[model samples]
Target chain A: MNQAGYSEETMTNVRAEKVREVARLATRTGRARSGEFLAEGPQSVREAMALHLHNAGHGGQPVVRALYATEECLDRYPEFEEMAAKASGVRTRLVSAEVLSAMADTVTPQGIVATCLIPETSLEAVAGLNPRLVAVLCRVQDPGNAGTILRAAAAAGADAVVFTSGSVDIYNPKAVRSTVGSIFHLPVITNADFGHTITTLKAQGCTVLAADGYGAADLDVLQDDSAARRNENQDKAMLEEPRLESPTVWLFGNEGQGLEEAEMARADHRVAVPLYGKVESLNVGTAATVCLYASARAQRRNCT
Target chain B: MNQAGYSEETMTNVRAEKVREVARLATRTGRARSGEFLAEGPQSVREAMALHLHNAGHGGQPVVRALYATEECLDRYPEFEEMAAKASGVRTRLVSAEVLSAMADTVTPQGIVATCLIPETSLEAVAGLNPRLVAVLCRVQDPGNAGTILRAAAAAGADAVVFTSGSVDIYNPKAVRSTVGSIFHLPVITNADFGHTITTLKAQGCTVLAADGYGAADLDVLQDDSAARRNENQDKAMLEEPRLESPTVWLFGNEGQGLEEAEMARADHRVAVPLYGKVESLNVGTAATVCLYASARAQRRNCT
Candidate 1:
């Protein structure tokens, strides 16, 4: 074993105990047992290394448990080599392509895989940011949808993303891949208590809105009203409406059933994205993107 | 043969010539040769049937050449039976689950499949709509992205969607599946001439905007500027910005490489959605959703 306690000789056995241990992280139970999940492909691994280096530089807990890469990948992307060497306590090892593939969930691992510690975050951590915009996923099932929304939340500059207890695991390998490295750019809280999460964010001056298709209020109207108010058009009647310009928490629901009656009831208002055509409903990711960006846009008038 | 030229008896043979013909529609060459494409599952077939019935009633060319469903599916979704019988020349037949499985591209066909006429649309058809918003995909390689964008465009009330010559076939089975029945909701032009498409739309008084990450203009700024103009803020120096409220065509490029330099040059402005965080860029579908919805919201103040 090297200083970081990984094999010195390149891992050549596809069925080695260490390889099997890494492969096991693909499963939920395996992840729970090991407290780690796999991040495959160069893009994901590159971001993982950046986070590891950042944590190492700061006095934060290191995120990478073990990183396995093929020689060809190291040759192609030299930055990974430089970052790995700089990040302390990361178990880095060179492995053959076959060994890396066996340890990855994707058919093509693209020559790199990392076992990363599952992040733990609390509502205090999120509220500490004094977030202007936040996204909450309540029972959103698909891993891809969760990842897509997380990535969108990050891109739209949401302070944090919270997934309710029944929602898909953001640390799932496929979900991590779907993030395309945006997973490292923002804070994410998984398996959160749905009711308490909302109430807490609300206490911190966040307007909690549920994204519902059958809602009475149209999102465009609210946006227009917000703009009109921002322009100092004092209509006054619509002043009681939920303000998009304020700090906000958007609750997105499952793909098929949408928000439960209880879920909708929990929100200050059930907001719907305008469907100008005959679409039954907007895909959750698309709806979330429009909603989060609306808040981002409404809140950024001063900054822009 | 029945009135529609298919056997009246139920199709039970999984390997029959007719089954092979239907299965072949999953491929591009087969779709081109037969001028038919397969739409699997009930939601998609339901939409196809609605279009077929509408066309048949209007003396337009009937869209569905054949409709196949398992007995269990028919019992579950009786609307298919009712619509199939109503549409003239629909050659509906009940197939066993095994036979339906053999005919579908998806692992689970969810009980119905339709082989429909390949829609042929032109610049004239789109121009005739007096469109205010249009989405143009230029060499966008992913079928899922193409389909998702189409669905988003339709939902955003885009008048039509245009696929440049090298882009994915909107009629491809995977692409059609991704549309989730939105494929039948709006006019789509495939294999379009990129340069001519931009020029013609421009000639028709449409502003063409290329969505580029490295764009000179920020979309949020333009949106803010448009709102300011609407509020009658006469800052005459800022009048030169592209207006998002005007009738416009948005050109989105490939998944890997965005719009080419020449393609960007063909547009009135290369507009970038403001990236609020550290994400390198937005996913094409996410970007398209934001851009189209921005245009839709800007253009709809008068209507809503």
Candidate 2:
């Protein structure tokens, strides 16, 4: 190896304990400590570096502490060098494929992994958009389900996603990997007080609607013009004389408990996907996608 | 322990090996021999059992096998007991949690899993659907992606899904898990010749549309009747005759390579999803959902 090539002599400590520890960080608890999670593959690393540069300009701390790039990543993507060069505040360490294997989360690492800090956004900042549609996750435990919901929310044009109590860390490595970079685009807020959040949205003249497995609000009925007009009138009466349009928040509940009775009661409307199979309910992710898109489709049609 | 509790005793050769082997079957080779892949959760198990019953009757293997319901599963829902009793040739056995754990695929199994022989579906049988819309997967390897695509196809009303060379096993436990039981409702065919399949669809006057990142056909063209008509004359001239508007087989390729040039060239139309991110492509599942739904939406509007 060339002396100047990646400065192997100056490489940071790859202590046995540290390797064992980071491997353990594969779990959710370890990831929360550093306020950082792992992102693998060339595409993910590139996006993290770009986001790091963007956020670093703000008072936000540098998110990516390490960039593990393999020979193939360097050779195949010359842009990796460009990104690494621009990430001035972030540490960029070059590791061999063998070392890379230890740090990488996926079975196939795609020759790169970057440690990225979870980005935090405030509810007020999100509300500033006066977003017509939003998604709320309650006690969603599965990272894949949570990540898929986030991806669906973004694709369906939901203004933001808020995680209520007991949901998995939005920054879990599996969740991040599952999002396939959708995490970079959406406004995600976690650990919210569900009741207060609903109240606050109501104060802002937002209609808080929770998706219930069993509920009276027929989504199909919501599509009807007569029913929508009735909803609009009801919204106007609930708030004030001025009648500021009420934004809608679509709440999804935990996998097992689903929506709490209290939460369901708080919702202006409770709705479900009409299902036709021996299987009673769709998977949480699928349900969220179908619901979010249904809302989006409805809103788009109504607006036009 | 009761003698009748477990059909096979704990001391038998099958006990320890069964648990260890189920754990080891994470690899592909092991799954092939078991002839039975795991399906997790009450929902997955329910779907698998129904499919098993349906296929058993269809294939003339109508000998209903023993029904092994774990104690926990029975405790959770007593309703299963009544249903289990009514089914002919079904002998119910109660398995301990330990034995159930050995058979589970998840770290925290939903406390329910069922074993069923893979349902066999021939390509000719599915093609007989006169499938107005079919999803064709060529060399897609990820179990999650394959499963999600199948789920999406079912949701979007695709008549069937055909998997070609290099595709993951649709019957793999993880793949089945990912499908969310959509596998039971839809027709899925695996291990078909890619070239022959394409030609077969083409001969039937079915448009073989391939999804490509650099597709010439604008996706919006399908949404508007005028645009579709405008392109129809040009397309007809190239084909030497006007198409009578038959069914369509939409091809999705490997996650990494996408559709090959030769495959795309054979396509009656090539369509691409417009993306707005540094990441080049959507996850295969998301991409397939957007495309399939786009076509379905178009079809719905045209029908009305």
In the range A1-304, model 1's lDDT, one tens digit per residue, is 2433344889899999999999998899999999998889888888888888888878876788888988888879878777777775788899998898889999999999889998777988888888889999999998888888888999999999999999998888889988998998888898899888988898898888999998877888777767777677444435657888889999999988898999889899989999988888888999999999988888886334
For model 2 chain B, the run of ten residues with the poorest summed lDDT: B237-246
**lDDT tens per residue, model 2, B1-304:** 4423234443222376645665445556766765545666777666655655665567644222444456667678665555554445454556556766666666656566555544566766676666677889988999888987888787667788899978998878778877877877777788888888887766665778787767766443343332233334434433321121336678898988888788787788777754423335656676676666656544543333
User: TM-score of A-chain in each prediction?
Assistant: 0.94, 0.83
Model 1 regions lying over 4 Å from their true place: A1-7, A233-238, A302-304, B1-7, B233-238, B302-304
TM-score of 1: 0.94
Query: Could you list the CA RMSD of all candidates, in the order they appear?
Result: 3.0, 6.1
Colliding residue pairs in candidate 1: none
lDDT of candidates 1 onward, in order: 0.87, 0.66
- 10 residues in a row with least lDDT, candidate 2 chain A: A237-246
> Against the true two-chain complex, what DockQ does each candidate achieve?
0.74, 0.17
Steric clashes per prediction: 0, 0
